[model samples]
Target: MLMTSEWAIILDEVDELSNMILSSEQAHSLRHAYTAVYKDEELAVEIAAFQRMKDHYEDVQRFGKYHPDYHTIMKKIREQKRALDLNERVAALKIAENDYQDLLDEVSLLIGRSVSDAVKVPVSNPFFASSGSCGTGCGTGGGCSCSS
Candidate 1:
């Protein structure tokens, strides 16, 4: 006969643990298509491992909830739930790191393309001179204005 408080705590912990596992799975899916410089695959593997741990904890919780010694079992389940919470935090951190790296890669690519275009454009091009100077005085304060 579990107390109401104990049952409430158990249900809360179970919900939290389930949410963590689902979040980790989503992160893993994101990493599957990622081929950035960061080791997203490794992070995905770690997330998967944590998800498995959460699942194992869930199984223990289910079994313990039905045991005759409900109080003791509930306590153990709470501890396991706490561990699952910690693992979820780790997975979240990994996901954040991977996302940041992906963003960095995208920015780098954009910058690289811009730089490449700048280098390829000839200096005689009026559009390049105007655009680069922002309509400011070009080539020494409008000293050499291109009127072509």
Candidate 2:
């Protein structure tokens, strides 16, 4: 397959972006925060508890609301979710992860717009939720106005 000069340049630019991502401050912070989260024994216990509760909930889901332990499973799941969500280490890790993701998203948006507004870019802006065809998970789809 023959590759055009423009496509070759685009590929080189993307490679540069990947290098930037590797050295970005957010990437370092994300790794540090992720390590901290895993090193904390308290957080690990909470995560384990949450996983167990989730497994229990799935097991009960087969019986639907008719299960005798449905109410108990629901209550436990809520409790576990709250415990995990409220952890400071987990929260910090999430912030770091989002920061890194924001950098990547900005790069993608820039590349997309450089080509055309009709080009879809996946963005995970916390403040500005897109009505575009890039869903919450950030994937391109038809009829998207994701690029800016």
Best by TM-score: 2
lDDT string for model 2 (1-148, tens) is 7899999998998788788898899999999998998888878877887888899899999999999999999988998888777888888999999999888777777666678766656567844336332535444543345443
Query: Which pairs of residues have clashing backbones in candidate 1?
Result: none
Weakest 10 consecutive residues, lDDT, candidate 2?
126-135
**Over the stretch 44-72, how does candidate 1's per-residue lDDT look in tens digits?**
57556556665666666676757565665
Global lDDT of model 2: 0.78
* TM-score of each model, paired residue for residue: 0.23, 0.75
Q: RMSD, each candidate, Å?
A: 25.4, 4.2
Q: List the residue pairs that clash in candidate 2.
A: none
